[model samples]
Target: MEIKYIEKVKKAFEMVHTKKPLVHHITNYVTVNDCANITLAIGASPIMADDIREVEAITSISSALVLNIGTLNERTVQAMLAAGEKANKLEIPVVFDPVGAGASELRNRTTEQILEKVQLSVLRGNMSEIRFIAGLEASTKGVDASDADINSGLAAGCSISETIAKKYGCVAAITGETDIVSDGQHTLLLENGTKLLSGITGTGCMCTSLIGSFCGATEDFLVAAAGGILCMGIAGEAAAEKVGKEGSGSLHKAIIDSVSNMNAEIFTKRAKIHEA
Candidate 1:
């Protein structure tokens, strides 16, 4: 990867912390608090608005909109569409998280509807969720990604991401032990993060929030997605080092702290990225 792209990531990180952009989230209630906290930790304000009445109002002034389908419901589903449409109208960035997409018919249908309705700038999800959204066969257990591992050697992940991005005309970000980010024309593979992330409940949700934060501060959706993923991975590794043997609880808290204290220097030093 070129150093200039990495420089862009660094600039985006600092810009988010400096600007503290307002991020409107129509996210699931399950990991709502974690999403808010992570947004704040990365120096962005988060507003969780599910009510249809205020969604448009909130998105009107927000810099980015995050729509997560972790805990879907009828009311929130409409609210997400309302907010996402408003965000698009206002030319604000929209980051989508198709959580548990392939696990149930409801989730799958909801995801499809959101994709059709919203003009997303970034789509972040696990391998199975992305595969399902891309109209491919995938195995998912409940809301979590399947136990089947993603072999890093295969080009399937990169090709799939590129295809999805081209098909949808948005940045496709697939997260695993290795993260693949593609904007159809450009594809990147990021090697960062720790296994402790698997033990956390809201890490993926929080990552979506982080992506929103970065996208809110930068116009480059590809760079924004990569920065968010790298930030989470680096913070997870730092948190593990701080409290790896302690417990999941400690590690979770430490991850937030690491994000709070993270700087551009640390990000540039720890980021292991390459163009696919």
Candidate 2:
């Protein structure tokens, strides 16, 4: 990317600290705590509330809303719809993570329901999940991308990301060995993460949270999406360097620490983003 684009991302990253925006999430229980912590680490407040009675109230008070279908249930699905509608009426940015989208009928149905009801600012997922959302052949192995799908490479990812962005009318971010962020008109390829990032659960959820944090602080969803992905990618690299042989347990803590310590200078210098 050009220096100007990098500067735009840096400004979005710093605005998270300046605004300390409140991000409301109606996410699955599996990664809720880690999601909240990662949001805080990036200087945004997280309120994870899914009670149908209170979801609308919570979303109304927040700057951004994140909806994740990681662990889907009938009740939470209803809450997600209610909260999403409220967020839409208020013009709050919504980030949707279609976790395990192609794994089962329930997930696929829920993904479609959310897309029909909510106007997402950014739609982020793994290559398999995004491909599934784009109505393509996707092999999703219970919330994880199949090896064959992961090996599809950047060219395929860029096309799918753009297709989804145009179809959904939002920024589409497909995260993998190479993360692709596109808003139809412009696409960015980011290569800054570690393979070790896949060793742990909730990293993808955390990445979505980071994106929501940046989205909460800025109206430019494209830059906000890129900034958030870049933050998680850089943090993973930093954590991998520190953990060394200690394994995923240590890397988990170090990842949060790196996110908490991330600054504009570090983000700008270390980001491996390019325009496509």
**TM-scores of all candidate predictions against the true structure:** 0.97, 0.99
Best by TM-score: 2
Task: Pull out the clashing pairs in model 1.
Answer: none
User: What does the lDDT read for residue 162 in candidate 1?
Assistant: 94
lDDT of each: 0.91, 0.93
Superposed model 2: Cα runs more than 4 Å off = none
TM-score of 2: 0.99
lDDT of 2: 0.93
lDDT of 1 by residue, 229-260 (tens): 99899999999998999999999999999999
Report the C-alpha displacement of residue 127, candidate 2, in angstroms: 0.6
* Residue 50, model 2: Cα distance from true site in angstroms: 0.3
Q: Candidate 1: where are CA atoms >4 Å away?
A: 149-153
- RMSD of model 1, in Å? 1.2
lDDT leader? 2
